[model samples]
Every structure is written in C-alpha cells, then in structure tokens.
Target chain A: MITFGKGNLRVPKWSKRVFMVAAGCSPFRKYFPEYKLEELVMMGYKMMLEDNNLKLSPLEIKDSIQFAVYGQFADHFQDQLLCEAKIHDYLGLDPLYNVGIKTGGATGGTSILMGAQAIASGYANCCLVAGWERMDEVDTRTGNFYISTAACKDFETRMGRIYSSYYAPMANRFAWAYGLSDQVRAKIAIKNRHYATMNPNAQQPGDHTEEEVLSSRMSAYPLRFLECCAMTAGSASVLLCDEEMAYKLSDHPVEVFICGGSHTLRVADRRPMDIPLLPNEKPGMYDEFLKKNPRWPGFESFLAARFAAYLIYRMAGIKEPIEELDLVELHDAFTISDVQTYGDIGLRPYGQEVDYVESGDAYYGGKCPSNLSGGLLGTMHAVGATGIWQAAEVFWQLQNRYDYIHGDPKWWKRAGKKKPKNWKSLQVKDPKQGLWVSHAGVGSHVTVGILRKAW
Target chain B: MAKPAYEKAITTKYIGTPLKLHDEKPAWVIESPRAMTHIHTYGLLTPFFEGLTKGKLMATKCVNPKCPQGSTWLPPRADCPDCYERMKWVKVPSVGTIYSFTLVDYAGIGIEMKTPYWQIDVAIKGVDTIFKGYLESGKPEIGMKVKAKFRTEKPTHTILDVCWVPA
Candidate 1:
C-alpha cells in the first residue's frame, strides 16, 4: 500500500486492491425502539470483528483499527455533527481520525469510499465504515419532514412536493416514452416481493400479485404505496484494509474499488433536456419530446445515476458492463427508479428496460441477476444504511457465502417454481466481478463501485 | 439452485406498546408548541425574491461575446456558469409551457396544499430555466401554455408568492 509522508506523498493508482475483509448488519426492521444508535453501531462492529476470524488478541485487533467513519442523515432525531465523536467514545477505541457523512441515501456508499481512501492514502492501515438510521422513532408526518430535507427547501418542499411527487414525473415520462403500462410497473413490485420472501432480513416478505400491486393505494399518481420502499431502522457496516492486511485477517476477502461519483444540478436550475434533439427533426418535435420526455439539467435524478454508472464503467476499464460484471446492486427506492437505473447503467438502451424486464434477463439465473438480497424495495430502506448494505451484500456474493431463504411454496410455484439462484453460487462456478450503485437527494448525488473476488 | 438450511428465525422486540393517541389529537402531533422558521436566502439570490414581491419575473443573461455559453438563466445567478463573468438581470415574460407536472395526492408537514393539487415545472418562453409552481385552475397537461399569477394582495417574499394559471 502507498504510504503518505511529508515528501513521499504521491497520487495512488487505482490498481491498488483495497480489500473488504469483514462486514455485518443488524436485522432490518420497520421499527426499533429497544436499541439506541450506539448500541446498533457497536452490534455491527462486534459482528464484523467476529466475522473477520482474526487470530490476534482483542488489543491487537483494536490497534489495527486506525480510524472509523460514520454515515447518517436527519440529525433532528439524533446527535447532529458530534455523532462520529460520540460513536468513537462508545466504541472505546484509541484516539484516531473519525468523521460523519450525510448524503441522503448515498451516505453509506460515500462512507465506504471514504474508508477506502483512508487506507489507500496510507493514512490508516484499516478503517471501519458504519451507517444507521432510526426512522421508526418519528411518526409518518415527522419522517416525511425529515426526508424532505434532502430536496430543494426553497422550491420543492416550499411548494408542498415530497420525494414521491418528485419521482412521479420521471416515472410518468419514462412510461409515456417507452410505452410501458401499469402492469409493467406492478411486475417490478411483484418481482421484488418474491425475492424479499427469501431474505429473512426483509421488512416485507411474501408474494405480491401484479393485480395487487396495481390496485394498491396511490401515494403519487404513478407511485403507489406498494411501489415504494418501507421505512426501516437498521445499521450496516464493512471493514476495509490493505491487501496484505486483509489476507492476514480473513480467508475470504472481497477486493473493492471505487470507480467514481457525480452530483447533478439543483432542481430549479435544471431544464428538461441537457442535450437538445437533432436539428434534422421536424419543427416542434423537440418541444414535443421535451413534453413527453422528462429530462433534467446536469444529470437530473434519473440521469445522475446513469452518468455515475457510465463514469464508473469508464474508470474501471469496463467496456461491456452487462457482460463484464456478474451482478449489480442498484438503489431501488422506487420500482421505476430501479427500472430506469437498469437502462442508465448501460444494461439496456434508454426506453428499452421494459424489454429487459420482460425477457427475464434481470431475474435470478437470467443474464444478469440484480438485487438478489431483496433490494431496497423488498428489504427495508433505512436511508443512510441502504447503500452500505448493498456493498456488504456484494462482498458476500463475491466470497460465495451468501444465503437465500425460500418464500411461500404456493407463490414459488406461481413464479414458475424456479428457485432464485444466488449469484455467489454462480461466482463459485465461474468467478468474476460485481457492481454496487446508489444515489441520494432526488438523484442529485450518485456513487458507484466495482468489486472482484480475490482468489 | 439448492435451498440453504434455514437458520433460527430472527425477530425484533418492541420496548413498549405501540404508541396510541390519548385524545382526539393525531398520533404525530407534538404536545409542545414548536416554532416553524423560514430559511433566509441571501447574496446573489436576494434580487430574485425582490422581483417576485414586485410582481415581476427576473432572469440573468451573459452578454460577453467571448463566453461559450451566453444563454439566459432563470432563478438568476451572479456569474455565468461557463465563462465565470458577471450576468445582468433582465425582466422576462411570465408565459411558459408545462415541461412536466405531478398531482400531489397526500399532504404532510409544512404543506398547506389540499389533496389532488397540481404542481407544474414550467419552461419559460424566453428564459432557459425551468421554474416550479402550483397551478391555479384546470388540470395539468404537458406542453400546456401557462402564465404567472403573482400574489398581489399579500406577498410572502418567497417562491410561493407566484402561482401559475392556464393561459
């Protein structure tokens, strides 16, 4: 590993392998009144130490942990700026560098990135990244208020618009442009619920019929209550260290490499299209396209995820993402968001995700299995912790140690009796690469990482 | 695919019974009085609100010939994004087209909107920026022409001081 010093400091190359040797998470629940944030964080940390399987003594392991990074959002319910320091004290670690990150839903992914950077820069031999959210402490009204803080306070919240309303327009425009029907959207919900039944940690587990999803109560016109993720309280964490240190700590190490990240423009400053249509098009065609196509300026929420994915692929030297990567963990806060992300990440062309979803290419045992851990839609969504959980799932998949829980037998038969194949099993058969992506704040900020299994 | 051995079922325990309302007040109601505060916008954005209170829509345009992007900007900024030069504020027409819209079906904290209210993102006729506001009347349609309706009787010095209407 490259070490930083007064005169030896140099830009580290992306070729360096920053291995994630240990990962842990608390059972995601709809509510958690019995556990405090510190208790949850300590639970994850202790679990990580146990999972590490290090032969060293407790003091040795503690000395190896050079720093810690905490990710969270909505400080109104907890300690705001001092949360990292508070966690440091609670963990009883030697004085080391610690900081907190707040990037809406991308907090977890950002924290992981920060931890990797710390190890790569030689600032620390090992770094602990943790994220948690206690949304169940507040009621729906208070939760809505807290979540709305991510949006433009002067424009969106001021005009009585929530995240559902913000994402509804994009969903409508994509449906209109791609000729997608309500049934297509319902299918996504059903698919996630199907996988959720296999994830014991999932908040909502069971089979949901397409009709059931279509008839669900509508929150915003295009987005229904069933189509959105459940509010959950949980914590997720991962331990990052240098390649040598990882080998010394764990037998199975997943090498994680951050490709890149990007942020989009403000909601008010953005236009429908960042790039105008061809001049060869007939008069008023651009205007008509803009009317039907919801484009945002500087990578509006939908485009931001796509842009980040493309940048990551480019940085990681991945020419064909679908063929090169074995699996993907997309941020699926909303079904439409997940579907559009498939197209944005270059798995399919724009407006062609409907064909991909229908072709079973995105399903387990299909061309590219996504969100085998029940995703945010099936698994609960605990804002800051969701992204880190995605990364941890990927690490498990790379190590070929992921577990699956089968859903109801009746629903399984209805879904063609095809058991959901764990991508980790496939990796064991033909080991390769995987990816994790997440975004926050109405798609203003996005983070993407590519991971590979180290033999 | 092989089915893995199921582990012991994991569950969460609640510290107390689910919270219930004792009186007619909603479960989410704060027992103590809480003060709602306004976020003050300053610096380059002060004039934008000043124009709203005066029943006018203002935008900024970069006149530098050397600047690559000499386009006009709504929600006016002090400097050109491309050239980093001072941009002069200019009055623009209130008419525009609905770029996109969504009907709010649920109301939450800090929102006085009734159910099924319309929110539109309008692309101004001359300005290059898209402004978000609520519709006064008629159902929202993409590409529908709209005009700004300023709150003349009482101005709040906020973006809500202006609403959109079918033109």
Candidate 2:
C-alpha cells in the first residue's frame, strides 16, 4: 500500500508536472439550447490547446486517446479513441499505455483517480486524465438512444427508452425504499441549484425555490426536470506527475492519495450491510428493474458521499459513523442525486434532507459542506469529464481559493459571514487528511479517494 | 412513381415467425444497414431487452437476498452482484403505465427515424419497473395506460422487444 502526502514525500518525485488538472466545462441547457457531440469534443480540445500549443487535428486527438477512457457520449469508442489519440500525438505525448475506458456517469473523477493511481504506482511518470462529451451537440434522440444503449440497450434503447427513463425507476425506488417524500427530493434540487449559482462556470446557475422545483416539467414521476441533471457538452483533464515533479511544476500543487475504489457493474446487485431497503426482494429482478419501485436516496451525489465515507474509514483506520469529514465533492449529476447524496453521506438522516437544506447546513460552511464549487447539476457534466471535474473542485477547495476565483458573493452574504480571500484555496489550517468521492453508471460505480495535506 | 403492391401492407412486422427467430441472434446480423436503428451496442454488461421472445425481460437481482427488498435489478441477470451468486430468470408482467415522456424533434447518427418522435416511460411489473421505447400512438400523456409488445425481429431472446401501446 503506497502512502502519499503534501510534503515529506516517500515516493520519488519528478519536476514541473501536473499536480491537478481537468478538461473544461460544458453545461447543457445552460451552454446552449442545441449542440452536437462532435462539436463538444472540439470545444474541449480548443481549451486544451489554448493553454498548451499542442498542434493537432481533431482526428489525431481522437485517435491518440483511443486507448484511453471512453464515455457514453461517443458515437463509436474507436472513433472517440482515435480522435483523442490524434490530439495526444499533436500534443507530443506518445505511446499512451494501457489505453482503456471506464464508464460511470460523471466518471471523469474516477478516471483522474485511476490516472493518479497509475502515476503513483509508477505505471507512467506522467499521464493525462481527460473526460469529454458533446451532450448538447448530439441529437437528443440519438444521445438518449446511446444512453439507452449504455443502460440496457435491447430493452431500454431499442424499446425506445427515454433518457430520464433510465433513472426514473431507480429514482422511484430510492424514494419508496428510503421512505423519502417527494418534497425532500425537490428541496435537494433547490439547494444544489443554489450552490450552482455560486459557480460562475455552472451551466444553470441561479437560486431556485421548492415551488419552482415542483413546477418544473416532470421528466419522470416524482422527478421533475429541476430534480434531474441537465445534459451538457464539456470536457475536463488533469495532468498528473511524480510528487517531486508536481512541486517543481507549480508553486501551488494538489497531491492525490487514493484510499481505494469499489465500482460495481450493477449497482442493485450488491446491497451494503449498513444501508437498509424498505421492501423485501420482489419476484422478478426484471420486473423490479422495469417497475417504478423507488430506490431511496438513489442519486449519484449520495453514492459519492457514501463511498467517500467508506474511503475515509479505510484511510483513517476508523469505522465510526461518518460525520467527521469536513468537506466533500460529489457527482451531483442531478438535483435529486445531490439531495440523496446528503443523506447517503450521513450528513442528514434519511428523509430529513429538506430540513437540512432549509437550515442551510449543507453549504460551504455547513456541518458538512457539499458541492461547494458547484457540481454536475450546476457546473455541467461534460459527459466523461464529470468525475475529474469533481476531483478538481476538491483540489481547488483544498487550496482555499474557490471563492476568490469563482466569486459567489451571495453564498457569503447568505451565511452572514465575511468572505474568504479564495474559495478554491485549501483552508486546512493544520489539515492532515481529506476525502473525495465520485460515481458514474447512473449511480452504479462509486469510488472514493483519501488525500493528506502532505507533510 | 407507381406504388408497389404491398404499399398498404408495408408496415414493419415486429412480431412474426421469422422475426421471432431473429431474436436468437444479434440485431446486426439480421438487420439491413437501413433497418439498423442503433449505432452502438453494450453486449452482456447492459440488459439487451432481447429476451422478450421468451416473454421475459431479464435483470440482475441482488443475491444478498438476505438484504432488504428492492435491492434486485430488472431485465434479469446471469449472477447476483450483492451475493455474487447465480441469478434466476424471472418473467415479468407486460402491463405498464407512463411515468414520463419526451418528444424528440431531431435525428442522430445511426438513427434514421425523423423528428417529432415520441419517447415514453412504460412501467413493467415488480419493483422499480420501467422501460423506454417509441410511443406508437396519440400524443403521450402522463398516467396513460399501455402494455408491452414483444418484437420478434430481435436477434436473440435476451434482446428487449417490448413496446408500449394504449391499453
């Protein structure tokens, strides 16, 4: 088990390497009314090029990353991989090794975690972790069509499954099984959107009311548009290097300590011992999979939070109830996801999330501040890049410079407190450890990483 | 242009003897490039919805059968993820009600259908039951009642062939 930290490094370090990075932002419904998947990929590439003079054609970039991670948004894995491979070639990074893709909705964070592990494990001296998706640009019908393919192609996609339909059953099960009220889920949306307002980069940033959430067009029963994650076109990338190299690359660097990752191919397949389900197993798994049985607290945010807690216990060597963590960044792919995430992290008791939101206890300075820098619900998914984006947010917060860079004055004003110099900067006065969690696959794959401030 | 003799009867036959046999194989093998509506395939990892031939949509149930109810998956699976045990194929009822829906006005790559298509959320029996498919009927309204139609053109029984129709 390799251990990592901020200073007194045990591992050999390189210089001027990426300590923290991500692709870019793309929030659908917020970025534009319509865009294509291909266009979104170009947008992310453009951002990468702006910072670095990596001269390469779209095709080159696609091909270069072919061996890399693939998201649900791509038309063909080969096409996306080759397109990225070409870009890497242009960037002058060759022989991208163990090229493979991992899928979890908002899976970008996990990719970064994997990339960080690869770097830490000495698989590669330096590696780029990227997540991109053209959600807005792609045909909604086609995009959802692909999502259908990802979820359960034959039954869902060929049967003409609606995009939100993929989550509805799960969402319903979350509500019913957890004994959660619809109103609580609505409040989750309100709170996350409010958090998004603090993020300038967010796709749909604004304050929302419970009424607005309830009134939003219903995507699925008990799940309004506000409660769901709006699709977007965006990408994120994080460049990782050895500890020594990361320190040398930039004066300000964020180190990653991977606690552990547990991703399940099928979420419903494994039931954790601690979490309880309301009803007993139904006769047919297919029937349960198809019906609107609600999975209580069924959201990406909650899963990320739970996984983070699990990681915290693993890293801290404590199995006590998870209320000790100070901060978190989860894949709030949807408002409901964020709401359930609150409870999943044990920040609030199940079904009491509305009270938590009403108390304003789930904010940056709350008992356990969640999605302080915005989330997929607020920032924009960028398809594959979501996980990495979540990781980057945590990195920014650890630096304690988020407010300074993003600048959400309203958050401070609402708290009736003085504003900090930088919200993205780490605020750990004598910090020792921090935790990060991200999940994809419609809340199927949950991973957690624990990081220390480094000696 | 002169109309062909089968113009009136030219509707796509989703259910038939040959179509039923088609469910045993992958759609790629049976579908003409023109008939191919999907651009990608997820293989066994995702539920194929091809099992409608046997009148069942398969799903993976959480094998920790000891855990609370509702931990199971639908469409049936080969193994239980929670217990890591073999899964049992369970048949589901075809009845469902609309949970949500959308009208897509654009087409995508590999999707030959024109815009203004109706996508629906049709409820299936059992916990957390719901599946998607083209709505071949009047404008979709919430609370609309529909039943699952098994398609035969599916190349395998594991493929999802059900479509929701007004009851």
Candidate 3:
C-alpha cells in the first residue's frame, strides 16, 4: 500500500487563534424569485451584522471588516461571472479586496477556511466569509447537467450526467461491501427532513416515511429522489475574527478549528493507500477489517473526509468525537454520503456506519446527533451557500439561540411561511461544541470544522 | 412611426429575441439562453480515446525505475502522477471484475446513453484504477466477469465508445 511521506503528515498550525462571532442565511427555496442574487447576499450579510445581538452596530461592524472571502460554486447556474465583485459592492464594502473561492459543494467551508486563514495569519482582524448560489435560472435537468460537469468530462460526466448517478455507484458498492441497506439511508432522509421542520430556511422539509423515501422515483437505482439534495437558491454568511475581536463583537464567541483535505476528483483515480488513523484510533485498529476489503477508501468511504478528520481531531485535541461533539452537521448531499462519513470522521468505525443511525445516536437528543440543521437533504443544497448555512446552524446551536433564530415567528414570516403551530426545538441542550462537515464531488474535497463555545 | 434610424443606422437593432419572463409578480425572473458551445480538447490523452474505435484498450504506465509506483492507468493520464514524468502507452487485458455498479434511471440533459442502463466500474487487470463504463448487456454485480466491447463499427469517440458485457 502507498504511504504518506513524513512532510505530508505534519499537523497544520496557525499563528493566531480564530473565532466566529456571527452567522446568517437567507430563507432557502427551490426557486427564490423575489430578490436578485446580490439582494439575497445582502439579506444574509445584514442579518449577520444587525442581528445575533452583536455589540457593534451594523455600520461599525462593516467599518471594522478588513478583507472578504466569497464562495459561489458555478457561474453557469447563476449566469454571471465575477459575482463576488457584484456581491462585495452590494454589501457596500468597496476597495476592501475580496477573493473568490470555488471548491464545488465545499465552497462555503473553503471560504471560511480562507477567511480564517486571514485572521490566523494576522492579515485581517475581522473578515467576512459569504457564499451564495442562484440555481433557479435553470431547469432541474439543466442544473443537474451543470453540476455533473464538476465530474471528469472525458471519462465520467457522460456516463451519468447527473451527480446522483455518480454517488449511486458508491451507494451500491457501499451496500455490497458493508451490507448497507436502503432502509438505513431512508432513515437518514426521514430524520434530516423531520429536523428541517424546525428550520425556517429549509427548502424541502417533509415528514416522510421510509416507504415514501424508498418508493420515490429513482434518480439512479437504489437512490430515490428523496434521498438526494435538490437544486436551490439562497445565500449565507459568517463573520470571522481574531480572539480579541471575537470577544469584542459578542459576549458569546465560538473558537474555530478547521482543516481541509482533497482526493482525486475522479473516483476512478483514487489509488489504494493506507487508511489514515484518527486521533482516537490506534495504529493497527483497522488491520482485521482490512483483510477482506484491502482497498483503503474503496468505494465505500471518502478519503478526503478521513484525512480532514485526521488533521482536525489532532489540531483541536478531540479524542472521542461521538461523545465530545454535542451536535454535527454533515453534508448529506446524499444519504449514502452521510452514512459513509460516519466511518470517515470516526463517528463510527468502518463497516459499522449503518449502526450509527440504527443506534439512534444520529437522531435528536441522542449522542452526537447529526444534521440538526436539516442538512443539504432537506434544507438547501444551494451548493455554495450550503456549507455556510451548516456553520450558521451549528453557530446558533452552540450559542444556545436555536429558538430565537428558528422558532421565532418573525423568521417564519420573513420566509413568507406561517410558523407551524407545533414547532419543536431540535436544539441540543446547552451544547458546548458542534462540528460541521462540508464535502464536495464524491469525496474530492472535504473540510471538517469544530466550533467550541468560548463564552 | 419613423424609421427608427438610430437603432438600425447607428447600431444593429436588438436582434436578440425578447426573453420570455417566467415570473412577473414580486419580481421579474427571466430564464433565457440561446445556445452555448465549449471547445474541449483531449490534448495528450487523445490516443486513449482513439484506441476505443480501433477495438484496442490502451493504457499508460510509468516506466521510470525511480518512481515509487509503476502501475498502468485506464482513462489514462499522459503523465505518471507519482513520478511526474511522461508515461508510455501499452495494450492491456480488457477482462475485469465489476468492482461496483449503478443502474442509472434518471440522467441529466443531453446524456448520450438511454435511461435505465447499468453503469459499471470495472477493476481491469494490471490497471491501478477502476475504469468507469456502461454494461451493454447483462445484470451487474460485484465479482461479475465482464469484457470490453468497443464501438469499432461506428464510434462515438467518447468513453461510451467502450462498454463491457458479461464474459
């Protein structure tokens, strides 16, 4: 098996501590026609600056911003190139110099990574990390085609033009390799969509049954429509700063530790390699299991996610992730991806991913409950904005303000929806730490971030 | 009423057709696209695509003695990823096991294949990477034996040019 070099395995370090003080997102929808893309961005940006009970005024916070990082996944969907310039000017942050980040579905997490880098490097004391996507302009099939282009055009894109077709193979292989059932995947869809009932910004929240999810029209066989995240339009943002600025902005600031890892864009190219161990894992822990399935990442797991978790667990000094993390927000772009990640991030060991969901640990009020934000499955897969929204949800949960942000009537009204009479809070009780995983392109890129409440 | 001279005389009249608005209530939303074209190139990997039409499954391998890995790759890259050196072309065995498979029932717009077909990732012999292709016939399951069936008669010149059938 191929092994990593010593230099390749060094844990990442930052010169300064980073914290996230505030996050905001526009109400997500399958088709948001009331506002332009810039307007949606302004809505989220304004919410971050004005709401969240920040100590500084919106104008003052705008004044304090030194640099900006923007994430927009596909120019083809938005039909506009250089969208960062338009969004930056619309937010009235002129001449502040902004950089655009693109990492497919991981753009939002990568944007935060960029913004945090500026803070950690002492480049900017306060930085803005914003992300947006406008996919309503295109029909669903066209949008799927646009997304599939993210796959390798020559060898893969045409084989199945939809992203689900790409992930479906992994789902099938995962089921074969580890005996994953369509039932387990359906349960994830049900749980996340049920959680979406509490999220005002959710796009496809539904109280679905396993029968409904399994019976839903097939995108690629065994992967029903309900199991996949649909195209959406929305925006989300977060403000990152150094330690001093974080405390100055809010009485409750969360410490941020984020790291990223990437694999080959095409799954066809992921060569056999040794499985990198997480902080809690021992050297030879996977030896017995590897005897049967020698392919390390094999179609069943995401190496990028495992590599990211390997780094962040060490950097943040996290050892038992399933117990230490109060809540988690997985990409959930597909149910199989979410289930596969249980092993990759050490929430569960490899081959036991199905048990993570079956044990009820992945549900509300369970140990390290996942996708409390409704996830990309039920909420918004507005591509670029998805990762940012996950962080926003985690930030709110960590601040103990899930009710104020999600249960309030104003937010429901703002989204042009009547608040359900029985809006139950999925808030983790007094959560101290939460983690969000932003993933892209069948495990090509993944970022695992932990937010610890520092109040 | 007049000749609208400035529109035509000074500049070409708006030759573009009026874009149809999908929504006009809270906001005007328009979805208009005439057409688009992208001139993509196979570049150095042209030989791999050409081999499909010639009924040959060609792969590239790293021959550098200093390289850590020297395995052949289908969907071949012109350069070896480990050594960062030019690779040499070589014919490979077309038979492989089905490492994985997916039945694509729904596809994106302009998909070349018909809907509800078996798409398979084959673990070809001697190739370090699994090659993605479609199964022209037979049900696909892990460990199912399959052999390459090239479109030697009429070529699409795409990855579609090569498919697999139960051996």
Cα-based TM-score, every candidate: 0.84, 0.62, 0.98
The 10-residue segment of model 1 chain A with minimum total lDDT is A1-10
Expressed as tens digits, the lDDT of each residue in A198-289 for candidate 2 is 56556765578878888887654556777667666565655565666455444555656553234333333222223321122123432443
lDDT of candidate 3 over A1-455, digit per residue (tens)? 25689998888888999999999999999888889999999999988997899999999999999999999999998788899999999999999999999999999999999999999999999999999999988889988899999999999999989999899989999998899988999999999999998888899999999999999999997899999998999999999999999999999999999999999989988888889988778999899989978987978899999999999999999999988999999999999999999999999999899989999999998998999888999989988888888999999999999999999999999999999988998878999998999999989999999999998
**TM-score of predicted structure 1:** 0.84
The sequence of per-residue lDDT tens digits that candidate 2 reaches over residues B1-167 is 88878775565656743422222332221211213454655455344344565455555555454733434455455655344566555556667676556564433334433545666665555645345565666776656888766666644443435556788
**What is model 2's DockQ versus the real complex?**
0.11
**Whole-model lDDT values for every prediction:** 0.71, 0.51, 0.91
Cand. 1 Cα-lDDT: 0.71
> Judged by TM-score, which candidate is best?
3
Q: For each candidate, what's the DockQ? A: 0.26, 0.11, 0.68
> Model 3, range B1-167, lDDT digits (tens) per residue?
77776566564478778888888888887758658787989999888889889989999999999989997888899988788999999999989999998999999999888889999999988899999999999999999999999999879878899999999
Q: Considering summed lDDT, which 10 consecutive residues are worst modelled in model 2 chain B? A: B25-34
Evaluation by lDDT, superior candidate among 1 and 3: 3
* Candidate 1: stretches off by over 4 Å: A1-12, A52-59, A271-303, A404-431, B1-39
Each candidate's fnat, in order?
0.56, 0.18, 0.83
